[model samples]
Target chain A: MAEMVFQRTKGLQDRPFHYCPGCTHGIIHRLVAEVLEELGVLDKAIGVAPVGCSVFAYDYFNCDMQEAAHGRAPAVATGIKRVHPDKVVFTYQGDGDLASIGTAEIVHAAMRGEKITTIFVNNAIYGMTGGQMAPTTLVGQKATTSPFGRDKNHAGSPIRMSEMLATLEGPAYIERVTVTTPAHIRKAKKAIRKAFEAQIEGKGFTMIEVLSTCPTNWGMSPVEALRWLEENMIPYYPLGVYKASEEVK
Target chain B: MAKVLMKGNEAIGAAAIKAGCKFFFGYPITPQSELPEYMAREMPKAGATFLQAESEVAAINMVYGAAGAGARVMTSSSSPGISLKQEGISYIAGAELPCVIVNIIRGGPGLGGIQPAQSDYFQATKGGGHGDYKMVVLAPASVQELTDLLMEGFDIADQYRNPVMIIGDGMLGQMMEPVELREPKKRNLPPKDWATTGTGGRGHTNVINSLFIDPAECEKHNLKLKAKFDEMEKNEKKYEIYNCDNPDIIVAAYGTTSRIVKTAIDKCKDEGINVGLIRPISLWPFPYEVFEEYADRAKAFLSVEMSLGQMVEDVKLGVNGKKPVYFYGRTGGMVPVPDDIVAEIKKILGGAK
Candidate 1:
């Protein structure tokens, strides 16, 4: 008898996710699932799914999940974590959801030192809503809402979330990583794991902001999208640990 | 148990911590402002979360977030501040999340006053937000009861998977009295299997949500809520009957005003007039059955309030027009004294000097 080795993440069924082709959300989702599986905390964990392409994340993560109003995942996660501090709590949010609509919630959650992990995906442009410029959108990146390219004169510059959040002393750990290739994906996984580990260790507010590619929104092929993230987005975003106690030396 | 002098609002805050409610989100609002102030000092000692939210809206949503995660949570505000929380409260109710909301009500119709008033009776009883939802409304007439009811409010909220509201007047929130709190029971909430903890091999992710686009699905959810409410009405209706033995008149009141009415009933009895007091503990079910029973025996009923006739209408309906229900209230931050209520009770008794 052949060893049966095929199963989608236990909580996430095998349905095709709603993310656009070449969008890195699916990869991030898989990474999160793998971490949950590896830690043996899947049944004891709960994820707050954000509104965006990842709105259907509840269907993909086998653990108990909840959908938050746009950008309010952090606040919701705070609630869930406080009620069941023994349970691991996390929120999956997009650039628009976290940086735009959910700005106050995430900031206050961090300020309060909530013992939760946040997986913030910074894809430069809004993927689910069709190519609109996001708070994290690069200055020269042309989005549907910024057809003339993002103008610093009017639209303001891209927000460096990790840098800004790092300035605050609330978070126990903060890091930025990319998922452009297999090696980068491996590194991204390590950072993601570290963020969750911080939460498990009773550290407060660890966030891993993944610099991802939105091929459909950027009007590029998957290859070009990855290349574009490397050439343009990474230069502005700078993939590395902006703040971590281990990196203090 | 020995009684200790305590303000109603302060007692609620202490009782909540004793009840294992470790998270409290609130903004400063008059009358009930002491609640958050108390929690700010108490929560840290208990290893709890106490945050002064940017606004009442944010505070309530914070409670919503925490409660959704299956944590024991609470919030307190005055009438105007509670008005700001209506949106979040509606969302909480729609999602059937368990939590506690305390409204130390003031005169209202809009920023009416900072003094005590029962003007929010309609809002508390009839779902204060834009949905067909009901909160288990608990009205406390004394500081001791406020402490006890707040603990009960948390249990009932968790039991029914809905928000429970403790509605009091400003006087109830500010006034002090001796109270003896019972030892809290251990919280036995089943592991929040549905909370958004990282999935540890659970068959499916549990989702807490209020959005249902499909009409049939929405209707089904509404019916489930209605069934729970019907059960609550049958099992959770609570009221206290005082001097009901062969009384000529019954006075319907609650919260701070009820205590005043008690004093007035004593005065009326001294003057050779018989007046009974029906004080509702669970105000949402409104103790209609009790009113119906009293209506058959009494000559007339008078609804005493600190606001303009809000609960009087409910009393009239509860009596089903069997007796004339008259309303006498002092609005805009004014708390009518026992003498004022006694005068009204005498007038209703028709020239009983």
Candidate 2:
């Protein structure tokens, strides 16, 4: 029998995820769990799942998990981290949850310099709700609500959370990364680990925005979706650390 | 460890911090604005989280989020603001999350007034949120009680995995008194094993939610909540009976009004009027039996309140029509003084003769 070499990452259950094929949420989830395993912070960490496509993240992450109201994961993580300062607390939020309803919460948490990490998955469309225009939807991007593509005259400009948050002096780290390909996935993992490390170091407010793919919403095949992210999303949401403490160097 | 003069609202806030509460979310409102203010400055120094939400709705939702994450979270607002929080409160109740909500009640039918009032008696006791739910409501008549109740509220909330309400009025929130801050006992909370802390090989992941789609499942959940409430009513009902021996009249009140009544009863005693007071500490599981015993002997009972006539109904129910239950109150931002209560008690007692 051929030895099974590549399997789903540990800490994530064998159960098939609910994400559509080519959906990058699975990749991001695996990356988070992998980082937690590598850091050996799984038992000492808590994760808040947002109210979006990944609402069932509690089912995927092997660690203690909580489901927050739409857009309120940051607030919840703040609560958890404050109560259990010794434990690592992080929020896994989607574009809709983080950029729209939860805007104030995430912004204030960052502004207050809360000692928590936030994993922001930005696919630029409302996936679970079926392709609605997200706050981060690029200009001229086609979505269900933006059938004519996002009109700059109509819809406001896409929000760059990493850059916006970096402007605040409170955040110890802020970075945007993509998971469209293997090399980018590795970089994304490094950014994610840096965020968790910031928290472990008692640094305040670290967020990593993962530029993701929602093939189902974008109406593209998985491979094509990855290419689309590289060509279109990258220029709009450049992948790099917008802010990090010099001490981390 | 030492006595300090503190406003009731500030004392409650200070007590919560001392009790290890590290998360606070609130929107400013009259009568209770000092609570969030106190937390804002103190939480940071304590290495806690504090946020002034955009609206009362958002504030309570934030509290819901924090509580679900197994934090000792709290929120405070007056009547109108508390009404806005009903939606999130219902969710917190349904999720069985531990939290504390302080209601410094003001007069209200709608934006009623920014004065002290006990009008929210029914709302606090009957669960201010939708669905079948009950919060352990603690009414504090004095600054000491307010501080003690804040600590007790946290304990009760964690013990039952449910939200508890520290129900005070504007008077209690604003009054200043000497209070000895007691050292908080270490909490006996189980490790937030069920919290969203990363599972780390925990047997199974936990979900905190209020949505039960199936009617039967919803019923079962509600019934569980009801059972917890029943157990609380039996085990946690608390009240204070003052000068009940050979009293011809018993006064029923709570919170600041009860304190006023205490003084009025003293005045009544000076005038040879035999009056006593039964102050409900646990306003929801009211001291109904105690009031009944007093009603059994007293010829008349008076409910002196700051609201039009909210708690008087409870007093009537407790009295069970055995005696004449009179109500005298000042509403719409007006607070009835001790003299007003004494006058009413004198009239009721004179009529009984």
Candidate 3:
């Protein structure tokens, strides 16, 4: 007799992941997939994949998907959600896509209270573009573009996107969480589910920022990356509920 | 429908609604601000969605989203705003999504002025966005034509799975004219089986995207796009010939300037100087055949433009050295009157007739 303790979620397509080992994008993707399938909305889900590490997310998500231009996934999700209000629409974007180049789009989507959920992955560095300094890169974090270790005088400070977005009045739910440990991963998945639930109820805009790790760019081994994230990234980006409107609370 | 007096901007909005387009995403810009205002008030009544995007860039991208979901959608902006929308326009073209875009052009090398201009003639016809693509550019000389073009533009966009643009100027947008709005004709458009609506009823998941990372795969997509464009060029060429039976000179023009050229042709007739006009309705599917037909009959070809001779180059290419081509233009939101066009024609003719 054999027991199957782990298997791929039905929300995910039959394809090997392209993410590198220790890359938190794989964990984040699985959490989102599990959430979609558990909500029983996998067939009605349409995800907007950003131009970052998750750009090939369309090949991974079992449901319908759209690949948006650099930093424009929120605007694209807004369009999709407006046209098909019955369907569950969401965007998966990275630090460079959301905090920097796509600042206008995400802000406006939230301000308009668009019925779309956003999965914002803040890994503190540009993952797909080969270790470039991102808008969310920490003050002294080392990156290829920030070889001088991200001078505070020259490059300014890392953006606290979850906190900044929580200040807006439109969001129904907003939270920041990480996935370095079993407990943290459970909290992250719960936050993701709440964000999607807000969309399912046709409440308003919702977002979950996952403080992620870039093992290859951070020059850390898989285990070291997790330790580094726990020691450094967690303190920089505090994990907690930033906003929860009456509908989601 | 009975003819009703409507401003060009409002007429354009109504015309889009009549074309079965429910999703309208646009940002407010001068000369075209009334358009979004009109949609904001009217689209809701028709059970349509009207979104005033944060910027022109966001507006076009929103149009891209709705279009990808198989909803007929549209967006409008002025010159500078349209320039900002180019990136999304290129993506929309690349994905082979059908959507309508309206550009009520105003003066600009950079936010020059907001009165009226045909400066975007080159931008609209020569691919305003990056990459190898084209728009079915329709230049409407009057409010009536503005309304008609929008009604047909959406279908043409869906028919070829390409972006269709209606190019107007501030004059056409601001002026009030009588328009008989077409009945909401239900067109038998192709099923959007590939749209990212959902994978529920469909057996396989659908993907609506423009990302071709591999070079070879990207080229194959480009070739597919080229074939669609080739088909459009073959069947969609549109132009109107006015008083070209026997003439000493032919004036090539479009948009608001074309009407002035027509009035100038009347003035030339009164003076016993035979002049004619070749007004191109479709700017990208340019009617070069009209120029080739009258190439030898006319002594000279004159291009009357609101910008500094942008369309003259296309007129020259059309004439192909058969006749001498000349340009007469007014720049920076200046609208040329009939007398000005007539004067330019006489100068080129040099008392030949």
Best by TM-score: 3
Poorest lDDT segment (10 consecutive residues) of candidate 3 chain B: B182-191
The residue ranges of model 2 lying beyond 4 angstroms of the native Cα positions read A129-133, A137-155, A213-240, B1-7, B13-91, B106-114, B181-219, B243-250, B263-276, B289-302, B316-327, B342-353
TM-scores vs. true structure, each candidate: 0.84, 0.82, 0.98
Query: What tens digits encode model 2's per-residue C-alpha lDDT throughout B58-111?
Result: 678778767776678899999999898887788788888989999998887898
In terms of docking quality, model 3 is high
The global Cα lDDT (0 to 1) of model 2 is: 0.85
Residue-by-residue lDDT tens digits, candidate 1, B1-353: 67889888899998999888989989998988899999999999999989887677768877887887768899999999999889788888888888999999887778778888888888888878988999899998888889988998898888888899998877788889998887645555555555554444555566788877689999999999999999789878889999988888899988888888888888888998888988888988778878989888888888888877888888888999888888888888887788988888777777422
Predicted candidate 3, C-alpha RMSD: 1.4
Per-residue alpha-carbon lDDT of candidate 3 for residues A83-174, written as tens digits (9 for 90 to 100): 99999999999999999999999998998889899999999999998999998888888899999899999999888988888888898999
Ranking, TM-score, top scorer first: 3, 1, 2
Model 1: residues with Cα > 4 Å off, grouped in runs: A1-11, A83-87, A123-159, A178-184, A211-239, A246-249, B25-27, B40-71, B107-113, B183-206, B211-213, B243-249, B267-274, B298-300, B342-353
* Candidate No. with top DockQ: 3
